[model samples]
Target: MRPLADRLAALLGPLAVVAAVSFVSSLGIGVMLPLMPLYAISLGASPVQLGLMTSAFSLMNTGGQLLAGVYMDRYGSLPFIRVGTALYAAGNALIATARDAVSLIAYRGFAGLGAGGNLIGSRVYIAQVAPPERMAMVNGVLASAASAGQVIGPAFGGTVVELFDLRAPFVIVAVTSGLAFFGLLTLPVPKRPAAATQRIGAPTSALNRSVVTLLVANLFLTSGFGGFITTYAPFATELRAWTMLEVGLIFSLIGAGSVVLGTPLGHLADRTGRRRVGVVSTIPVAFFGLAMVLDWPRPVLYVITFIAGGGLTAFTASWFALLNEASPEGRKGRTFGFVSALSNLGTVAGAMGASAVWQLFGLPFGLVLPSLSALLAGLTLLALAPGRP
Candidate 1:
């Protein structure tokens, strides 16, 4: 236990710095989530306008990630982080100042670009610095931080929104992001080797195709999840008579489960083959989406959400492990950037698709989309047997 403590302590400093930054950034991103639709409605935004705002952010977030990856590969992580953090701060400020729905949508897209930069840069930085053996642990820790941020952000944001106004969350996010910018300055910038034969533009076709397939699967699954997340509050308000606090609490439950289980699952991913861990863990994970569709009692909903969060961490840990292992040497930064972007793409598709479905057919059909998405993700993983990799 002493030795384990020492090892964790040694890893904690750098990990903590990155995690802190991730936390603040994620908090900023998530703070507005529960309030977005409400705020838009207050601004006289039509349902279609609200949907467009969410879709715009998803699209920009995905596109920004791809660009961030290429830039990080060419330049370095530190520059991107600095620039991204600044953009995030700026975007939050814009959100605070937004006077109408159109402006809100435009500003959120700017915020999405910043988010893409921060997320991709952080992942690439972790992959570059952490020892290969400890990659899963580090990734898990980061994921946990992200989950913590997601959990806290909504609760905090809800309070801020209630206390002050819808714009209050944006102000808080701007401040938090501002602090993270300074925290990031303390970390050492990793040096990129100039003599390596592989340039940033090389094709990734020959690398582990299985890993790519898994990432695509994740994109599909996440898209569905994103759609549900964006619309869940609205559905609950309309269908279940849930308040903002209740919605925040439900989301927090999901985050808490991930924070608790993420590191252990990551360690397991390292000890066990990533592919095996992913395949085995996805069964229960898919059920979380199904549970939502089932419309279980509130207590049962919490249990299912917890289970789903655990499954999410397990899936993410293994997926990160596989991505790191499969990436070509010297290109992990770019590879991860692309993967990050792809996940955002999934969010865009999910949000837009779900919103459109809900607009047309109502909440039940919208819920079914995510449920089917989880099913497809599980089946896709099963089809890509580790033996093929």
Candidate 2:
């Protein structure tokens, strides 16, 4: 067998290209995430409208993955990625020019189409090129790169927003996505077996049943996590009167923790087993959620968020590895696509649920809901015991 380094170097040219595209695209999305509520409020949007706008973006993102997966599986990865990035660039440009909440929501939904396609395409590309044994490590590297983008995007977004206007971030996102489009052009095209053409059979009910259960569990976990992030800065502002810059710093720290912990944890899973890593990682994630609900001081909250971020990344890397391992060979692309879509559903639910709770009970209670959700998700994983017969 070729050495791991040799295998990696052989794939690195394409992998790095894809990772850069993914990173820039993700950075653009992250840059806009924290600013959404602020922008909505400025546009005189009601709380319901704000929730709808966020949900709309996620719903389209979730729904679009299924279509993207089919297309990629049938045609190839590069074509879809190129088209997706272009759409994303267009959507960002539209968002920059949006004048009303409705326009913003519409534009965001368009962007979600690109986001969904790009994400699935990137994963499929990685799986196609990387050797099976080294898949986890490559995924870890991709996750870390994406996390790094999340770290830089917000701080950069915040700076731009502070200096220019909300539109500035979207314009910057458009430019980055355009760059990603060009980057994807340099990669190799995936080859498909001519006989194995794309076709729609009846849904694989049995496979979907098993996969859907996992997806729902992921949704709950994602929801809890998404809810926490969605509400976190607001919670800090209400509790400690922190400024946007301070909130951005705190968020960046969380991303940094993910970047730091993701690869080592991924390696541990690969060496040991995915189930072991899943179980171990879930514990810290649960506690991190609990800690966030405890009304700790700013410093304490920061530490807790970092720990939570680490645990979250560990769990995600292991969980994805498990999913990849468990999926049927022919259906792997669809399986992952379904999971991606479901996870986005969870994010939307989590964000909406947290927003509602915050309005009803307050920040503390809202935050507590996510902790409870995470705890429940952890329990479900323990019950399922993936990677075992």
Candidate 3:
């Protein structure tokens, strides 16, 4: 058994630094998410326009991941991380000064580039440093940090918006992103080993039919969830007559569930089977998403949302563990980037389509989009499980 002191040191080392960077960067994103739709509305954005604006981020983010993936394997992730965090800060600063919905869309798309870089780079870095036996735990730690950031950022950002103005949150996002950039700069960079500098396009057996199947599953899953998020604030506000602060509180519940359950669930994934945990968790993830669309009491809604958040954390831990294990060793950057890009594609499809459905069929009908997507994803997993596991 490892000493307690050794465990503590491992927890607080470079791995922790990467997790901290993810937390700070994700905090900026969380700060803006619950408030952005309202801000667009203030700029006279209609439902379709709001959907477009929300999707602009995902579209641009996909492009960024594709580009970063090609290069990061050739170079390394540190430069991308620094640049990505800076882009987030700069984009938010621009967003603070936006005069109309068009500008908001443009700036947010630019910020998406930064978000993509940060996510792909961070994942690649973790792949390099994490001990294989504890990959799920490391992912859980990183996810928990991100979730904690989401919790604090939205709750605080909502209060800031309510007390001050819609623009206040953007300024706060910029500040937090800037802090993340500087924090990333503090990490040491040693010369890359020969094996670490392999060509980005090198062929590997890991990127086979099974991985492709999983990516397809990822696309469906993220799309449903992404669509749900796009419609979330507006639905909650319109159906429940919720205030901005109330909406933020509900949004924070997702993060709270993740923070509370992430580690334990990851440990569960490691012990049982990642695929089994992911498959079992999908039902609750879908159910809770559908539940939030209903007109439950506010407190009841909070409990449901929290459980949904836990479901998401468990599902993510399991799926990511599978992906990490399957990825080719030297080509982790490209693999992670590829998966992120596919996931963002689903986000774009879901967000844009959900709003359109909401506009045409009503909010409750639109809420069904993600739940349907989750069910499809679950079905895909079930079919593959017998073959793979």
TM agreement with the true structure for every prediction: 0.83, 0.84, 0.81
Please give the range of 10 consecutive residues that has the lowest summed lDDT in model 1: 198-207
lDDT of each: 0.76, 0.75, 0.77
lDDT of 1 by residue, 37-113 (tens): 88888888888899789887878777778888777777888778777888888898998898899998899899888
Any runs in candidate 2 off by more than 4 Å, and if so which?
Answer: 1-3, 36-52, 99-101, 191-210, 230-247, 295-301, 351-365, 383-389
**Residue 315 lDDT in model 1?**
75
lDDT ranking of the models: 3, 1, 2
Total clashing pairs for each candidate: 0, 0, 0
Global Cα lDDT for candidate 2: 0.75
User: How does residue 280 of candidate 2 score in lDDT?
Assistant: 67
In angstroms, the error of model 3 at 333 is 1.3
State residue 64's C-alpha deviation in candidate 3, in Å: 1.5
TM-score of 1: 0.83
Top-TM-score candidate index: 2
* Best by the lDDT measure: 3
